[model samples]
Structure formats: structure tokens, C-alpha cells
Target: MSDSVLLLRRVRERSGEAAAAAASGGASSSPGPAPRRKRGRRRRFYPEHRVYRARSSFLDLSEEQVLRRYRLDKAAIAGLCRELGADLESLTGRSHALPVAVKVTSALTFLASGSFQTATRDSTGISQSAMSNCLAQFLEALQRRAARYIAFPAPGRPAPPAGTGAFPGVLGLLGSMHVALRAPSENEVAFRNARNFHSMNMQVVCDAAGAITNVVAKFPGSCPNAAVLENSALARLLEGARPEGAWLLGDRSYPLKTWLMTPILFPCGAAEERYNALHHQALAALRQTRALLKRRFRCLDAAGGCLQYAPQKVCQIFLACCVLHNIALRRRMPLEPPEGPEPDPEPELPLQAPHVQISSEARAVRARIVQQLEFTVQMSCESCAEAVREALRGAPGVRLLELRLEAQTVLVEAELAAERVRELLEASGRRAVLKGMGGAEDGEYKPGWGAPNWAGGEGGGQTGPGVPTCVPVASLGAAVAALSGPGGVRGLVRFLQVSPQRCLVDGAIDGLQPGPHGLHVHEFGDLSRSCDSCGDHFNPDGECHGGPEDEHRHAGDLGNVWADADGRAAFRMEDSRLKVWDIIGRSVVVDAGEDDLGRGSHPLSRVTGNSGPRLACGVVARAAGLFQNPKRVCSCDGLTLWDERDRAAAGPPPAPAPHL
Candidate 1:
């Protein structure tokens, strides 16, 4: 035999011995010679032929040597596939370098499935060492290939002027981040290590033509997306790159960090939030964006299985799909049929407006174009509508900054009244204002008095009016529980409360007890169970009723309390049988006139809302917790109750508070 033949046989024999030893040492084995081949078994079915294994290099193989050794012959591979059951012309072809291509595809498939190296060895008839070397070389090649296909050059690196000799018109820049898969275990680790990284984040910036302008991928340790540009090859290309007057758009996740590349801001107005029915167009567009994002999320979830090295790469691939989306959008697809055979020439007519109004139309077409051009600015995405709405709803003393009704979007500016924006949004009748301020405590100020016969009166055995009281409930915990409770009183109602801690004005017509005044409960304790359960107006009777004089009846109809000339209406009429708390769900209405013990003719009546001109309203508390009156009652324009309080705290006419 030739020296080469002798070396090959010896190497094969050694490899077999090593494998047998490893298998024997790994687990228990019978001490016996290998079983002889069965009579019916094919002659070719030797131990080596029966099991596929990775080919080993000739001990001197370098990285280049290994790659060279596996460089599959195109014709030979095709013939081999034909000899097996696989079709060559049908399934494999010229564009693909068969066995080598198959090798690449198989590696990718293995990367995705996470099959063991042993399994791969069996399938490819390759040795463990050869398979390992193959993987490293394959990945390096893929990185180069993907760079050619997916990565973008940095900003300043725009290619030599297009063959057309003019830069593409209306360049649009889009950016997204994706997770790359690193390992099967890395997926779980990525979620847990919020600050660390088990996968790399991939960022690609694309141009109007959907060509990649920049590409970056890196492990997100403590670094942020803004910082990524500094480390990536894509960023190097972007150095000194200026996308002047370009329209750059991104989701909320994009940071506000200033970049050397472009200027970006949200498309929505300063006060106007996104997504809250900001006219029909915004709403529709927002819905479409949401659906698209949802699909992207689903794709990301599916990628977890295939991406092992930086598991998030699965997500990175998914984000690549976004670039495809932009390309599709640019193509004006799903394509439409030509309107007619006689297609009109491109006209100078105006484009349709998103929310067609003089202001909106003007802004979208002329103003926006001019403004962005003058400043070389890009536009960021509108905040998620749901997020903005939830914020607006919770903010206390929220001022409506701008309400472009034609645009149908409400812009509200509010200082944080609580720990979270949601808390402020949830309050009842929480209307956003443009200016001015008023709340429960506003009524507390003495606003001038009524006649001796006024509602909660004093003097002459009749009633006199009193100032509205705005008191904080002591227990917020109780309040939350009460309102959320099963029997919690909600909505409109009228009922009496005999307790010193609670008060309610009547809305019922019969005076609830005739000949005298009857107090009642309103609604909304927030489950506070505080004195402020049941908010205003209990009167079931629409017209203001039962006062000293005859007038139209109103909802707050309790008549004047009996008192002497002294300014006081004090009486304790508590009956265990006439439970007040039970009546919380109901109203205690007063009459159009005094119930005069069922006597006195001439239609015998008095006061309108029982001699009370809408004295006060306190929705009883429930579980919602202590209602903190806004420090500033804003009319909405930006004025706050705080302004008044600060003014008051400053004191007197001669001294204006010094501006900070």
C-alpha cells in the first residue's frame, strides 16, 4: 500500500478505537467482541457505514484547511443527491452550491433547532471535530454574508451619487431594535437580567429607497440605544452624516438622546396627544400601527426557538421584516389597478390632508414642510394613544392646552397630582380645562348671605344660610374600601344622614317628613365611607321646591331648618328605625313649600330648592381613598387654584407676590 493509504487506515483505526473507548467509559458496556454482521444484513453495512459521523481533519488541518476540505463539489454533490432519493434539478440548482450550500443550510437549521452535535454527526456523516470546525467557519461566513445583505453604511457614507446623479427625493429614515439569539438558556436570562444582556440588540437605519444606511448589533449591557451608535461599524459610516430636512420616524422606545445624525420630534402638537380619536385619520392610522406592531411581537415570540447564540437575533430578524414593510409601502402596494386607460398626467394638485381643516391642511402641506426644511428636522412617532389617554385621565388640575376640534385631538397639560398619572385620570367628572380653577373647597369661602328665611337658617325660629364646608376625610383607606364595596352607593341618589360625621340634602318632594327640613346623602364615597358619601342633588323633583316663597322646584329641595333669630339650625332627629346609611342609595327631597303640618292653604309654599339656592354638593366617599382637592383649580388655560392660594398666602392688596 502507498504511504498515504497506510496513514489513512491507521488514522481510521485510531479514531474508531477512541470512539469505542469514549462510549465504553461513558457508560457500562459488555466485555465481548463486537457482534458479527447478521446474515441478512447488506454487505456494505459495516460499523462505519451504519452510523454517520463527522470527518476528522488529517491532524494538521488549519481553519483554512478545514474549510477547503468541506468545499463541496457542485456536480458530485448533485450526483450524490440523485443517487439518493433527492432530486437535483428540481430541488438543488446552479445558484446554490449544493452539498456546500446544504452544509450551510444545515448549520443554520441546527443553530435554530439546538440539536446536539452527535445528532448532526449522524445526519451528515461528519466527525465531531469536523462539525465543530464547520460551525465556526459557517458562522463567520454568514456574518460576512448578512453584512452584505442587511447592514447599512454609516450616515456620511452615502454611495457615490446615484447613476441618476441626484439624491433620492424625500428621504425617510426608520430605526428599530431587535434581540439576537445567543443560546437556548439565554432567552430566560435576557428577561431576568434587565440591566445585562443575553442577546445583542440590532439596529438598522434605512433610507427612503429602503436601502440600509447603517447597521449595528451589540450586547445591551448597561448601555442604551443612543450609545450603540458609538460602537457599531454602521455608526462609523454615519460619522459626519447629516440627513438634512429628512423625515425620521420611530416608536416611543427611541430615546430623546441627541444624535449627530438627525433632528426628530413627535408629529403630534405640543398639547395634543396621539391616538385618542385625534380625528378619524389619526385614529385609523394608530389602529393600523398597533396591528402591525402586534404582528411583529408575534414574530419575535416565534424566533426564540431558532436563535441560540444571542437568542434575541430571532427578534432582530423579525425587525428586518420592518424594513421589508417600508419597502412595500414605498412600492405603493398592495398595488392598485390604473384608474382608467387614460391615466391623468401627474398634476400639481394638493395631497389629501390627514384631518382636512384649514389649519391642519396648512400645517401638513406648507407649514410643516417649510418648518422642517428651515430647521433640518425629523419627526418622531406620536406617543402610544392609550398611554397618553391614561396619563390625561389621571392628572389632576389638567389643563387642555390646545383642542383642535377639527383635528379631534385634545392636548392637555397637567402637573402630576399623584404618584401616577392614572390616579388623576380616574376621578369622577374629571374634565380637562383650558383655564380657571374650582373644586369642593371653593364653596367654603363666605359668598355673602341669604335672607333670614334661607335654607339652613338661624333666628326667628326659621333657618339662615351657612358657608359650604370642604373637609378632608380622615381615613383614606376606609374611603377606598367603601366605594369599591358591594353595597357602595354610586350614581345619583338622595337620602338622610342623622350622624354628626355625615350630611345629605333631600331631593324628595314630600319634605321626607313634612313641616321641616330634611338632610340627604349624594353619591361617590370612593368607598371612603367618609362624611362625603353621596355627591350633590338628591331632589327627585326637577324644579327647586319647598321654600318660604313659591318658586320652581329644584333637585336640592329640603326646606329651611327651624331656628330662632340667632343664626343657627340645630336639631337631632335620629331614629334607629329610620336608618340613614341604608338610605344612601336613595334621595331625601324637600318640598316646594313648607309642609305646614298638612295645613295652610293658598297653595301654601316657600323657597325654591327649599329656600336653598344650591347650597352645596358632596358625593359621599367610598373606597377610593381621601379625595385631595387640587391645590389649584384651573379654569384650564393654565391658571391654578394654587395661584389663588399663593396669592392669598402672599396676603393684601398692596403687595404682589414676587416672581421667582
Candidate 2:
């Protein structure tokens, strides 16, 4: 028999023997010293449940403190408790029942603090077991009444305020945010967003007043915005009702529809240009509302880190927070700036899209809107256009580029962050301002660089064996220099003679703002006055300071390298005139601005390209190459090769130049 069954039978047998003994003793009319019982172990008893009276109520805090901690003032909390009512209050008249306010407070603390382990114990003095009960009840209440708090405006409601760029019939400003979450146990890969973080994509629509009118949550992070909209309940409702002239303003990611308005990807005329500008203004309401949600409910904020909960629980928690956020907005709860790192300012762009058919009515509406509106990056010339293209040559996640010289606008469609692209453009010595963004349809007349295929491409596994672990080097003539300068400018440049007439130059420098800097070899390696003592450009042939491609240029003229947004300049260039053996002991330098290629009117243009002040330089010394001296650790300093690599990777902070 099973262990529990056997134990139960044994207990029954013992009880029967005790009853029989008591009956016999009573029949004899004598106790007989209680049958001389013998004792060994005592029986243990446990109560069915334990009543725990918590130490303090969170309601003891001041009004201001309450607003900051729970994101709801006392009056609002009271109203919420009454709304939840007996559903939150203890049902029994047992010893010191937990008040409904305590349960509400515990749930609020959990949401505001974004933690389950300490939120309850620290704020409400309740055990996790009790907190679980409170939070579950809170989510249940929200689930039942979420519709009451969040709803779209009535169809006949007055057109939105003119403050939203004076766009008539704007039903709401639509936006999407990715809510980070703990990796789910099942289907985990789907949770990875475009940023490669485990999260859930949440779509929201807010009115001009910054209240959330509709929210769709629980979609996978990898799911694109257009796909989310196509599958959302709101989309279905809009399609069924077909509200005339009323529409939603979404970013370029969303597909244009009759009831969903999107910006023009390429504004060819004054009307289309004005439409995009006004569309941006109307988008502010959605951004503000989304920011406020994450600020108040940190569980959704990335700064708070990923939410530590199951995938299903995460959805419920977000839903509950959204409902509470609407309630807070209605009650005029003030926005509080977080004490630490804030959420990302730019919203996540829906970089990928699934196939979806667009109605002809949608295009008709967009064309009509463009005719009604009139309004207005500098790609004014071919050189400027070429500079932009060169900067973005190898940029990752970039898909499309369309530049218009007449309009001085460039349309870039990329999965990459806008900030990164901006840095690349500035690196070309040109200011790039993001006017706006919109989607590109299939078979559109795209100018400039043809878009890279976002789907499968022509690459597969390589046929030939890849390079070995050994670093490549030029054994014939190789030299190296470790460059360090003022304000954290530092780099390692390697010079190698690859052929009889060609020399290879490559290195990576850090600690520069996003832009171009002149690179050249100086006449001397002297450090007596830091960079000032490096003398002029190494013009052994008495040539002018020109670009690497110029025949009449100095042997030291290596041109410029671009720095990305993170202040890292990585470059590789080849020069025919730069002989590795000729300039072994000379110094290479970087300037503070673009090399004008002897084209400027300044007297120094032919001598220094008017490329501003010398920033950093280093002396060249012969070094081993081509599988030579490939040791792991240095015998003299005891520094392992990996250690050296890590040190270079960490980089140095900005400081004054070193002196001899």
C-alpha cells in the first residue's frame, strides 16, 4: 500500500485500542492508575492556516511621498479602493483582517518599484505569499474593468484640438514601445526585439490630452508594428466602422491606410513637405503619453531592467499598469522625473514588415491630404551627396537611401537607430537634420543607392578555408606606432609594404567627436612640445599637402578618417607614394577637422590643408610581421596578448598630452 494510506490505517488502529481500553475501565468502575501509560514521542499539531498581522500600513506616509512612491495621491487611492470594494477586502471577520487599502498599497508598490521580492515587505510589511494574493486580486479587478478606463473616442466626438498641428479628424496619435521582460521558458527566441533585447511589443494610441485611448499588449518583440496593427482589435473595429475623415497618425513604420495616416517617405513638393512637418508636430502627444507610462510604472521601463516574471504574468501586469495610468491621467497626477537613468528618448522603429495589401482608398486619402497641406537635410550638390553615401558605405542594418538635391532632403530607411546614421552623416563634414521618415512601397522609384535586400541574399558558407588564428603581417617591411594625444586621442597604426609600389596603412583611434579628422605623417617624431614639436607634414619631395590620390602631394598626406557616434575612428587606406622604409622614424598625426586638400584660400591650405590643429601623433618603429613573434605573453612585462587586446579595447579617457 502507499505510504500515506498505510499511515492513516495505523493511526486508526491506535485510536481504536485507546477507546477500547477506556470502555473496559469504565465497565469495571475503576481507573486503575489510567492503565499505567508509557510515553516516548509527543504528537505534533499544525493549524490549517496562520494569521499574520502586518506591522505598519503604507498609508502612514505623507501625501507627497504617497504620490512619488505609489504614483497615486491619497484621494485617488481611496477612490480606487472603493471601486475595487469587497473584491479586495477580506471576506471573513477573522482576527485583524487586512484592510482593502493595504492590499491596494501593496500592489501599487510592486508596480511602481518594479520588483516582487522587496516591494511588499518594504512598503506594506506583508509577506510574499500575502502580496501574491493582493497582486492577483488587483490584476483581476483591472482585467474586468480595463474597458472603463481605456476606450477610443466616440465616433461623433468633436475633432481633436488644433494643437496637434491643426490636423483635422485626428482620432489619435499611434505609437509603439517595447517592454523588456525576463526570457520566457517557451518560444524564447520570438521575444527578441530589433534591439536584440527580450521584450514584448506594445502598441498604444493616445489623444491630444495625453491619455491612452487604446492599448494592445503581449505581442512578441520581434513582431513588427504593421503586423501588430493588422492583427489588433482596433484595426478590425476601424475597418468595420470606416470612420470618414477620422484617422490615426503613425510613424513611417506603419502602412498607410484610409483610416491610418503616415508621413510621406519622399516629399517632392511644398504640399507633401508641409504634410510631413505637421505630422511630426502631431506625434508629440503619443511620445509624451508613452514616456509618462514608463516613468510612472517602472516595471515597463528599461532602466528598471527586465521584469522578473512569467510571460503571461508580464502581460497582465502591463495591462494593469495601463489601466492605472489612465486613471491617474484622469485624476491629474503630476509626472515625476525618475531619479536615475531615463528611458530611451527615441521610440523603436519597426524595421521589418510582413506582406499586407493596402486599399486604393488609403492612397486616395494620402494624395488628397498632400494637396491640402503646404510646408517644408542638405544634399544640395553631387559632392555633398557623395559624402553622405561614402559615410554610410558599410553601415549595418541600413536598407534604403534616396537623396534629392533640389529639396536638400535625404530619405534613409534603416533598421539601425537614427542617432547612428546622424553621426555618420556629420562625419562627412556636413550637418544632417532629420526632417521626417515614411515607408517605401514595393517597386517604388528609389534613387541613390539601391536598397539592400532585407530578405535572403546571395551569401552562404565560404568555400575556401578562412584565415588562421595568427594575425596577418608584412614581413618585408612592417612598422607600428602607438599614437596618444591630448583629450584621450589614442590609436595603433600599422604600416606594411604590400607591393613594390604600394604601402598599406591601417589603425583605429578613439576619443573624437563624430566627424572627420586629417591623417598624415609629420617631419619629426619629437615630443619635446607634445604635438607642437612634430613639425610640419613630411614633404621630403617638396610637394604640396594634398590628398593621397594627388600626384603632386606630400608623401605624408594620408587623407582623413571618419569617427562614428561613439568617438571611434577605424580606417584602412593604401598609398603608392608612402614607402614603409622611407618614413620609419617619422611621426603620423590626426588633425581636428576635414582636410581641405589644398583647396582653401588660407595660406596654410597648401601646407596643412587648413585642417585645424594637430591632435595626436606617434613615432614609427620596425615590428615583426606575418606569423612572426606570435607569442601569447610578453617575456619582459609579463602582459598576456589577451590582456593587451583588452586594454586597447577599453580605451583611455580624455586627458592632457604627455610631455618628454
User: Which candidate number has the best TM-score?
Assistant: 2
Q: Please, what are the lDDT tens digits per residue for candidate 1 over residues 1-660?
A: 899999999999999999999898768765678799778855653454354334332223443332223222223223323443232122546432225444443443244234555566655556566556555544444443444345443344333221111111123243434443444553365332232434445555554344454455544423444445446654453334644332233332332212221111212221111211222221233334323322322232223332444443444444443443443343433322211222211111111121211222212221112110000001112432333344444233343333233322333322222112212332212222112111111111122432112112111122244522322222121110111112221111222221222222211111122234433333333324433343443434454333323344333333354422432223322121222333334323222223332123434233222222222223332211112232244566576533542332111212221321
Cα lDDT for residue 625, candidate 2? 40
What's the true lDDT of residue 415 in model 1? 28
Q: What value does the lDDT take at residue 155 in candidate 1?
A: 46
Give the number of the best model, judged by lDDT. 2
**Cα RMSD for predicted model 2:** 25.3
lDDT for 204 (candidate 1) = 54
**Backbone clashes in model 2, listed as residue pairs:** 274-375
TM per candidate comes to 0.28, 0.50
C-alpha local distance difference test of each model: 0.32, 0.70
555: Cα error in model 1, Å: 54
Task: Give the alpha carbon lDDT tens digit for every residue of 429-524 in model 2.
Answer: 665533322222111113333332222211112223541211112333567777888777887776655332456675778887789999989889
